[model samples]
Target: MSLFARLAFLMLCTVIPAFALASVAVAGSECPAVDANDTQARNSLMYYVCYHQSSPGEPAHTALNPAELPEHIKWTPSQGHELVFSQTRSVYWIRLNIRNNGSERRLWYLNLHYPLLDEVTFWRGDQPEDVLVTGDQHRFGSRLVDYRYFLLPITLNSGETRSITIRIHSSGALNIPLKLETPEEVIAESNHLAVTHGLFYGAILVLAIFNLLLFFSSGTTYYFYNALYMVAMGLFLFAMGGFANQYFWPENPKFANTSIPLTLALCALAMTFFGRSFLEVAAHTRADKTLKAILWICAGFTGLTLAIPYSQAILINTALGLVIIFILSIIAISRWQQGYQPAKWYVLAWAIMAVGALVYAAAAFGYLADFLARESLMQVAIGGQVILLNYAMVQRWRLLNDKLLEVEQKARNDLEYKVHERTAQLRSTMRELENANRKLATLSLNDSLTGLYNRRHMDNILPDLCAEARRTGRPLTIALLDADHFKAVNDTWGHGFGDTWLQLIADILTRHATRPRDTAVRFGGEEFALLLPSTDLEGAQKVCEAVLEEIRTTSVEAPGGAKARLTMSAGIATLLPNENQQEFFERADSALYEAKAQGRNQTVIADT
Candidate 1:
């Protein structure tokens, strides 16, 4: 048989016997019919006596009539033991035998208690042989389903007997007493197994709490769903009797029976919810709807099982349905892997959960028994599922964080690019503005017609030169020149030819005035001035003579295809320490009038 089938078989075998024992009843009349004094009175009334045999390879057996057995088969009851029988009793009594069949020596004990009477006792015997009584004496505690067997060993030889006696006393009446048998070794093994299972359960609980704290801190949907998932799975592990309760509530026998299936159902539901949210399934694809439907179906079936209690049938159907759903999940994962992005994590997580589920199912069904020290194979399955789901949650978080970083980086890069582009544009505009400003400055200070400094430029420089000459006690000269008969030339040759003649004279005067500090200006119509720094009247006269010679030699072309010769009359004046610019210019004007009177083609100097 498959592991799942074997597990189911074992579970049915174990659980059915418990149910039958719990339901057994005693006949009231049969209890009184047996002689209280006779040793066989209890045996005759006891319809069945079940016990673990001391020999290896012995199948569990029950005797219908213990009174007819040989001396070795019958065990003497303890003092004041009353075996009562009734048809309506709710508990059964049993005897178990323990033997040390291994090479190592071992200790054994029989544990039985009557909660109704508040009494507990232990029976110890030798290694060769013994018998033990283990049952509820007064119908207290939870109703006894079956007797437990314990193996307590200090030392024993191979094939030695580790046995004890158990006298079952009943408060309620029962006609036929049923027997429950289990090896002492099996019970000891179970306790140790419970301890290990409990530890694993604690681990899962811690993980759940950690994730929950993370959820509150981060406020992320992923952390919230992950926390829920871990809590659900943790509860499922606890319900399965893996961890804490084994040490604390081991006597609360109904915990695993009642809570295991319910927790599993709820866990599956929570996992479905977690998967949807973590994968962003609804936003990403229509497959989320299908998953929801599957979740609903599983939930519905689980609810039905809870609402209607039945023995084994409900459990079987639920398990089978879950198995089918798991198969479908596998197929869905294959399909999801083809194209869905979120499915990458969803499918991987489900795959691991699916395998864990299968292993759990196998153990639940009694298909494969656990050989481990502290837990059943099913508990291991639960632990595995918890780990895989946790890892998957982390993976989902990482994927989201990576995507967020990518978007932020892109935004930053785009912003930088725009800033750089704007900077380049601003630089281009600045260069254009600088060029225009330079041209404006040139136009403001230069004469357009004569290509010489304008009167405004000369007026601004002359004051600075005057101040410097007075401070340094240097000679400064100002010379005024006027083209003689310039108006008559314009009349004869047209104003255009007159303009050409004036341009020629301006060029000659500018070229002949050869000092860095000299100022040449277009003073007015047919009038010009040159200011010379660091020069006396004599130096000024020499500069004026050069100007007069150049002006006389230079010829201009008239607009009417005629040639014209130009000459200018010059007047020079020197500045004294006390002479102002107006006084100096008046003196130069008088000299220029003298030169014009003297026939206007020569230079003249002002009287010192």
Candidate 2:
């Protein structure tokens, strides 16, 4: 052979084994070999079969496929003797063809996870068992096993096909058959995922319920918005195959496709409304209005997607809308940092919700892939959003309470200031009135000559005194006294001497009064009057006689150094009950006239 031909043969020898190994790895060993004549049978098979040997190091059995498994097919870790694969799909009839190429007899039993959905039974040669072999060894005695068999049952010889017929019901878990090999480790891992999913969904539900309660209790727009937002977040988590379906309603798959877009739209609406209220954005600037308009447009598009029945369109729009929301959240945060105190909480809450929404949107749009056994990231994000929003709401409530208290305190302070001002004004007015009273008392009722009660005081108090005398049946009397020949004295000693004489007489009358209730007034000119409450006619006459004698004998020094004699006449009268001041004064005057007519130095009393 030539050198080129030998090199080609060596290359072929090396490449052929590699190709064979690659093919075996891609397609499992249990996969049926394709034949040119069996095109129809090849086209009908939905899944390729692969197998691994059972050994001490390896698990009992394993299958490998290049195509990725669905999210629901992921395994969880749990301890159980039996394993079942359960799934729900719109497509009908799943075909399972197992090729047992092992030499040893294998004893296996099959039990449906949801047994009420269907009955499955295996055919053995020409005879089929009425009851299927179910592994219930714990309930049945070991010696009385119902359908015990090795890998090769006596009823099935080598190279014979044994088929099991599964009849599916149309609703709930009954809608699909559970297919799995016994004692598989994948079932345990899947159960753990299912449990975690349930817990996550429960947490979302609790947050939603709590927010709803707060909304009703407070009636604040923030609480209302948060409630709606939390509810949407919870539904989104459920739709994403989180705790909701795993624990609460695992059998139903209808909500899986519908809740994602619906929740996204609702959350967007809630956040927009919340921003408007919490930040008081409408009051601050016009940017809030633009955001609101955009949110509404997004909502309209989401509704249109729902109505159109196109899943891909809905998913795409949902992703875009969520991105817009995240941008809005960043803008809101920037505004808050710029000194809007209320905006701080709003931005923080929205930021958390944005992260949750993005995670869910990524999962929905196939932007991120997740394993089955992992807890749903969307559900965790919803929980985070709920916590953040609740915190924001609490801060908002505290801020509002503080504002209300400040307003009330301000109002109270204002009212107190007004009251203080008014009280000060009233006190000033009262002081002015008291000063006027003092001045009036000095001018109208005080005697200029002797600082004693004047005739004006008599006029002010005499009527009340007479009325009191009548009521109490007490004696009331008056004495009218006049300085004698006051004109002659004024001519001889000048007016100053005459004034001195009059002042002396007023002082004498005031000082000589018998009781505290007695009042002496400078009547006018050289005249003076004395009022005695509780004094009768006899008592007044005696007091007047004493006053007359004292005035007659008293000597007054003139201003020019000459001595002068001063004398006075007195007229005494007792008050009559129920009489007018005029009548009382007339009686006193008549007595004074009689005294002057009889003599200038004597005292006289009027007849009753």
Candidate 3:
């Protein structure tokens, strides 16, 4: 075509390629370079991450290839060790453009500290053979290293730069902490964790066994619950610490993955029952019902963790755990406020444990960064709780023993004094017996709810009143009152409100029956009887109308902020000479029916 045209085309191509390479080099400068002689591990290396929306059935490797990954995603760089994605289904691709600054070949371990990830694929450069796939979702044997953490061994040549990419996906919290460590560092870290975890789980086991024995010997339910709590907490921490999959069920990936939430749920359930019993929650009526409800919810949640997805289950379990902690704290504080001495220790112990648990949960959900011994903080808190609870148990036993001794001493003193004061003691006993008989008689003669004369009182008093009216030749009348729409009130406003309505009616009857010879009686449900002595039917009717008028004007509280008025139907009957008490009651009841049939809220006198 032409010499100048060809030359310009070649120059343009060369300049454009160089400019692109320079841009990449500037971006790569942000990444950290590893030196073989470095003594410390590198956790805060600059890395670029991108997320891929993958379908459910897609394989992790095929979801996004490293070569074709950046078509739609822009690589975002994150500084420090804040690699937290809370419980996601999307695949994350993390790229580290690292250079080996040393002059000699060096081998390093890329450790992913979180082992609960479902799938993790790490590779150096673009080669498929360099990829190593391992996570808790796979068999433990598939991991390159035999450690609890996912450790991949990588070799770097002297003065070489390579791009390391990691693909991670999980059905749990994706709070991955990645580190580049030398073999010595890995060994040291592993040894430190082993010693700490050994002590942690070992303490839990010992406490469980000791409390179990105590439960068998003493038959105390709190001890049994505490033992179960210890066992469940130990298993849960074991699973969460990645030891369960490594040592217990290496080949059973599903069980290993499920164990974390399952054991945690069981731990929560056990703690709920233990708190209820240890705190003596049943002593408080509302708190007792609340804890009972929590027990049922915890049990159902524990079973639900088995069937639901791990992400959702773990979230719900954390929330349930927090709720239990709050409820127990409230009960413990309430007991302490009421001067229950042992509740002080429970409050202190649970406070420490709750703080630790909240911090641990925050760290796990990526709210807090890892600090010194942060992972083991919960274990320490639980250990403190166990010791404090055991101390409380001992103190309670001593208190009980002291009370028993006091009771024995009092009994001996009473025996010694019995002979010296026999006459006075007998007189006091007689007085006490009389007082108890009076109280029992009052209770039998009165309605428990309304505190008015009951049907039994009516049966005893009506015959005497009729006989007296006949002897004295005084006009005696009885009024039977029934509440209008009483059943409808009960059905609409609940039985408790209906009870209140009955009490209100009883009060009106009481106000009208103020005379010495007048009596107010709760005959049955929603029906009241009033006996007026030395009064004619006219006087009884006037009293009844006044009572109905007061009831109609009195405001009864209804639902929805509206006020309601009450009404009643009353029938009056006057005793006749030679009429029996049964005949008098029947006539009064018939008159009441007549009043109700003639529309309620009015009084009708019986025909003599």
Candidate 4:
């Protein structure tokens, strides 16, 4: 079965489950200390984990005013526990107290750590009306600081207690780990995180190069697949780490949000193939079929990520990805049981990656909470897994090289038949490509509606047609045709009937301008043109009369079954000596205006 089909079946058979830790709360006793002269300037504000949920229905925050919050709102001491809630539309309320007991009042910045939250609103001081709002969903300008994480700075007075209330909500996982930081601490930590992410990407790049070198040296498809897997994982990691938004494209949040599924599908595609190759599943009928289906599905999914909403795509991708990883792990372990040594490493690598992915996915889905679960845990797991997989590929290459040498010692044999078969395949592909190109070239020149030369092709051939008239000394006739009362028909019967009327005129022009050197063009909108290389104004007028007669005889039904007859007015001009194509065409256009002025459905020959 296809991976999509299998996933649908699995989803149908099993209930979608959510994981969430039980709420821990102690009323009105949690506070974090602030000192001006502290050597370590950053503190985890792990206290006052009070929550008032909304929409999904929990108690609303009673304490909008900081001065009287202690009396009205029950504050829950977090006991250094992480502030986590599952993916909810409900606005969560969290409160914390900061006391600066030092001689000097100091300013501190508070960062919520999670970057993907949809909204973060902070209330500080005695003012009930002041709220600082910032989040990924908000414009970048809304944040007090120019950072990816939600950050707001607050001032602490000496020997004074300050109450802080934060309201946060998201369409994604709500894992809030707020930190109190001095200016230096925030800068130092940001730098540290940047270095860590840089190392992560650098490792991926080096590993990709290492595997590609192995491929070049060993000439094995194994190395190729290994390199591809690392590259895809690298892309996924860059987007997941928020580096894509931070450095590459800060302004485009939609692209940043959409990049998740794009990279996820890429990594998923690589994993499906790499696992299949490592397990040698193609030799097994049923196992190979599953792997192939997974490969195809992941490829299709990567393309679909562009058109679908990011939230829906991310949810579907995360769920299906977990299922695929589980299946691959099972396959690897099964192969190891069958005595495949490479499968042993495959299982180990898959385990590390699977655990990390599960942790990240859990946090993303609102089942898991903690900064470790959301960030560092998965990065460590992926870093370790990439190393293990690289080692595994090297081992495979080593064994393969040994086998190759042993085989070489026995004999070297090849056949002309294999070359012949490959050559025949190449020939067939080439022939098909040539035919397709020819068809495309023709389609590019011709108008789809009228099968006449479009303006683009006419522009290309106009100079040549002008040159031909000059060289042959033939009276080259240029006619610009317009459907009479075209706009009136459009107004009466709508655009569909208008198109029919234009097509009827196009057909009449095609039949009348049928000389070997003549060309018919649907120049633009309702305007048609004819180029007759050897026809004078008199001869062109005859052709124009014929077109007029055809239009008079022909009739088409409008939308409401009204008989619609379309007539045409045209201006015919023979090429003038020493005049360019533009000048000649303009003179013809002037004549067309004169024809419209004289009467409806008549030809006016140019006197210029």
Candidate 5:
């Protein structure tokens, strides 16, 4: 048989006999009655239980006429403990017959201790339409009584008998512990539970903060992982206890249902990594690989829970949790047996926690009886695990410190040699830094795409070049070249092709300005400038003509296998005596416009 099938078979084998004996009460017995004089809390009061699997939306009290109701025929007698349906998507209806046996009117509170249930609805058999609904699936304000657990007020007039039915449903394990109690009794129980939960949460917060501080001080990554694990565990407990629904997001039903599985999955994921770090299993290659696989599985489950339905998510997460617990326990034991001293405490700590978690899971799946308080049991187990882990960490600290002291003594003897080696390394680093700074300077001055001097570089060198030309009386020519119909080329072919055309133009310009004093500049988009220091206007025009001819002859392939030619317009100006940089550029710019005005793909020279 498969593992799940074998588990189911074992569960059936374990529960069938007990179920038979507990359910062997008088088949036709009416619901148990509560007396007016009874002041104590009644635990596990017997009631009739019926399945509402056929039509989940239909109430259990569907019979219109009072005489049509089949109280003893359809409903089975209770087993005198919490009802356990295991994990299911089915709705269950519980019937309780209450009578105010005494003369005076009686009032009592009905408490359902299972907080994770999605819905709990209460209604009188006579007035089924008038229902009071409350559960984790609904807003907290909708509860019949202002309490975390499902608390409903019941009033019976003197000498009156009323049949009450509760419809319950959940996506998780369904285990309902019913109790009839007085107001004082319910308040006392709530207070006690509140204090216990407060301490548990408070300890989790304190420990998480403490571990975070340790991580910061010691620079240990495992301490940070442990802190995350503790926080996730605390949140999972909060969700399981229904405090997330009650106190956190009271109005969001989706979040309330999602938090339980989501938090548990996250907790498991954190535990997986924390275990890897705590055990330092990397030295054992096989164990490290196994933990890596487990970590991925946990992560997958965490993500899957967010997208799947609550019913499937909870079932999968619970099963995954069991598997993880088993795997961690085995690894811890194996490491301990391998003479890893620190793993000794981990083995014992996780064993207690694994056993506690197993018992709780078994009870959830109906494989074990709900005799013990499962939540409290797991909390105690976690508390014990935390204490043991604290001691283990202390031992780890001492071990590391001892190693550090020995290393320090050896390091002192080699300090002088190490310092000389570091000095050599520093000199090499300074040389690399100088090279990097020179490269950065080159990058800042050049156009990124065209690999030519940019406008900023042109601005910096033009004034000095013009002053030298004026002092020596040797002519300096400035030529501006703009691609003809550049926008039309971009619109026709695309911007990518346009960028390639600009790079081709830049290459042509670089070829003509090959002399030591000649500089090529890509002033802006689709525009090129050549600064010729010892050349007059005529020499500059010949350079522009050569560039234009090369570009015109060159053919580029467009998107549709068509060859397209390139064309440009150029304007040349020779430095006039006493001409400023701006005037010199503007005269060239005007000549470039004149070239465009006369006709594109031609060069024009300014008046001397």
Candidate 6:
């Protein structure tokens, strides 16, 4: 070839890469070596990280598949910190490589430390079928690992290198904080965080109880509002730290998005209530009126969150929060100057919270370093605020005790002491009775053996259900199911094994009727009934078949290492127009009999 031709080819090669981008692929060389023997868990993922950004919307995510990534895409090192992105409508794809250089298979835990990313998807390049998709926009249970954050299990065989691709999209600023750790390290961190959270919540509970007790003793609603304020702040702290996702409302992702708005509103209201009561807003009408107005506006903004977009709701909440804090600070300082002893503590607590919220917001907006935005930092400030407020209440309690001591009237003190003791006894006895009543109520409505709703509960609910179906004109279907070959099994493996077989059937029934309106009842021994609200004949049949299929696939282990496949025969009937409760029940029951007569372990639909 001529020298001119060779030079032209070289220039073309270099120029093409700039336009057709491809991020550095995760390969054997790219996967950094780790000291497996070191047995330490830490932020060990930065060195193996590379990232590419795509334009906003679903198309960007779809366009940047691992195979279709632009050849000229540039990748930069993470440098021991998260890749922080400004708040914009963009899709960020992160890549990491791991190679198992060991002689045996190994598993590592991967955690994407940020919790608020709207969507996150993880793809294991080598395992085509095992892509994991989860994010805040999805239910908490949808995550592969049930941790609060985006955690996943990564496994590799000896000499195997796997590339992991993560796609994240959000309107909020993005922080790509990834960590790879051993199983022990993961467990250790989990336990430590759990313990710390337990202490935090426990402290809040104690403060609430103390304030509540003070309210009861003094007959002052001031303490009552303070207790409520404490509770609200506790919830806000938990919501911030993703503990609410971990424990309370995991399946409700839509509600999770609303939590911050609702929490801010509730906390603002509680603060307003406590402040107003303590300052006697009726007496200080002018100063307190603006506070009340701001609180109401916060409430209005919170309600808008239900209909409006999350970003707008968040902005409204933040603005109201800042305004409320500023006004409250001024009021608290003013009250302290007027010699209100508790106001001093309130002022201090308010200042700390303001700082926390500011830092937290800055981090969220990408103004501060990503490392400083851990929800635990916010929790610490909240905890401190709660402690300071409680300390002020403790002082009040001490003063009250001293005043009682000063008025040393023996008979009055004796009477008061007796009343307090008797009150405690009554409270304890009432609590015990309430607990017993709850258990008794549950027992009355539930089957003793199967833990499903009893036939009596089904009878109670069916009439109302039929009436509702008539009103709404929505189809309501009922399925009556029974286990097949019951007597032969009882004779073969005794009653105990037969009981196990029945329990297995009950489990399958329970799985299908999971909705709040759906009811699974233990009609009788080895007989079950499912009430599918708003379900048509076809849907009811599908549910019954799913349950039956699950039972058929499951093996019941009998005594002495013997196992048998469990099966159920189900019959479905949709409620007809003008059908009474009895007619509906009878129709379903007739279908069940027909199913038994036709063939066992099969589902049959009632003739219209």
**Which candidate achieves the best TM-score against the true structure?**
5
Look at candidate 3 and give me any clashing residue pairs: none
Error of 6 at 127 (Å): 3.6
- Per-residue lDDT of 1-608 in model 3, one digit per residue for the tens? 22332233233222221011011222321344544445442644424332233435545435555765534444445544446654455677776655677888888887778767888888886666788888877999988889888898878888887777788878765666777788988999889888888887898899899999988876678999989988998898788878899999999998897888788889888988888888777655999998888889889988888887776676677767776887898998998898777888888888888777776665564455552245678888888988888887777667656754553332332233543544344322543544544476476878988999889878976887798899999988999999998898888888988898888888888988988668899979999999898999989999999999999999888777667677999999999989999999999999999999999889999988
The residue-by-residue lDDT of candidate 5 on 1-608, one tens digit each, is 23453354344333331242244435553555645345442543643333333234444345433344455444556655457765665666677776677787777887777777787778765565557877877888888776778887888788887777777767666777777787888889889988999999999899999999998876677788889988998998788777888889988988888988898898888888888888878665888888898888888888888898787776677767767767877888888888778888877888788777766666655555552387889899999988888788888777766765554332333243543555444322433544543465477878999999889878977887888888999989999999999998899999999998998888888888998668899988898899998997778888999999999899999889999887999999998988899999999999999999999899999876
Q: Using Cα atoms with residue i matched to residue i, what is each candidate's TM-score against the true structure?
A: 0.40, 0.40, 0.60, 0.58, 0.62, 0.58
Question: Candidate 1: minimum summed lDDT over ten consecutive residues — where?
Answer: 111-120
Residue by residue across 1-608, what tens digits does model 4's lDDT show?
23453355345323233333345544543455444345343443463345545555344533333443334444455555676765556667777666676788788787788777666778885464457876656655677777777777877777877767887767665787878788888999999987987887888899889879877865656677878988887877676665566666677667777887788887788788778876678565888988888888888888888987666677667766777888988988887898767777878887898778776776665556664445778888888888787777677667766764543322211223433554444322433544543465467877888778789867877787788789989888888988888889889888987877777777778788787668899978899999888888888889989998889888887787778887888998988989998999998999999999998689998887
Please report how far candidate 3 places residue 275 from its true position, in Å: 1.4
Q: Which is better, 2 or 4, measured by lDDT?
A: 4
Off by over 4 Å in 3: 1-32, 40-62, 71-73, 125-129, 371-373, 408-608
Candidate 1, lDDT over the whole model = 0.53
Q: Which residue pairs collide in model 6, if any?
A: 20-71, 20-72, 21-70, 21-71, 21-72, 21-73, 22-70, 22-71, 22-72, 22-73
* Segments in model 2 whose C-alpha atoms lie over 4 Å from true places: 1-195, 242-256, 341-360, 371-375, 414-608
lDDT of 6 by residue, 124-193 (tens): 7646566777887888888888887788788888887777778888755676678788888889988998
lDDT measured at residue 247 in model 1 versus the true structure, 0 to 100: 38
lDDT of every predicted structure (CA atoms) = 0.53, 0.53, 0.75, 0.72, 0.76, 0.73
Give the range of the ten consecutive residues with the poorest summed lDDT in model 2: 14-23
Q: Candidate 6 — which residues are off by over 4 angstroms?
A: 1-42, 57-64, 281-284, 370-373, 396-608
Over 301-393, each residue of candidate 2 has an lDDT whose tens digit, in order, gives 668656643244344445555555665676677667777665666666666655655544432322332312112555565566566666766
**Cα lDDT for residue 216, candidate 6:** 88
**Model 5: what TM-score?**
0.62
Q: Model 5 RMSD to the real structure?
A: 21.8
Looking at model 3, residue 502 earns an lDDT score of 88
